[model samples]
Target: MEHSMYPSMTKELAKQRSDATPEIQAAFKAFSAKVFADGALPKKTKQLIAVAVAHVTQCPYCIRGHTELAMREGATEQEIMEAVWVAAEMRAGGAYAHSSLALDTVNQVKSRSGA
Candidate 1:
């Protein structure tokens, strides 16, 4: 089934681009290379972090891309799952934290109105 959210490029076009667009491919290669260049974190850890960011940002393309890269970088399934869970928790916490401002405003308005 075709997803309506993302445009479906023609298979022939995709193949042709895959085969012929050296510059386009090099851009992506440069991006991936730069993402792993610093030794601050191990490659697997960085890839897992990328996967977690993808999950939190809700980018299907990035999630799929990073998941594969993480696995290729030797991230265990457990590590990948943990990263996803961490992202979920952080997203949930962020939403909950923001709700407090609304609650505080409501409380202040109610106190001012004596209701």
Candidate 2:
């Protein structure tokens, strides 16, 4: 059955991209490995961060991949939930931070209109 919207298309596209540019693919793979490796932060912590970032980015593929990776790396459900909450807070904070731009624009418009 040829499904138009195959769920595995993410993997297939990644494979195709890697096949088309092995060097770039290798570099990315190496970089990702180094980033996720245990150093100051534990692997489980890194995976939890990734899961949180995936949630913030709203990437379904990344969310699934990192959630599974976090689980495999021994992140508990509570920890994952906390990470998600952190992401939520950060996402909202970003919008709140950008509200300064809106305030500035409003002030400029008021000044121009002598309001």
Which candidate number has the best lDDT? Answer: 2
lDDT of 1 by residue, 15-72 (tens): 7887898788889889889877658888888989999999999988788888998999
- Clashing pairs for predicted structure model 1, backbone only: none
| Model 2 residue 16 lDDT score | 91
**Candidate 1 structure lDDT:** 0.89
Error at 79, model 2, angstroms? 0.8
What are the RMSD figures for all models against the true structure?
3.7, 2.3
Alpha carbon lDDT of each predicted model = 0.89, 0.93
How far residue 24's Cα lies from its native spot in candidate 2, in Å, is 1.1
Residue 69 error, candidate 1, Å = 0.4
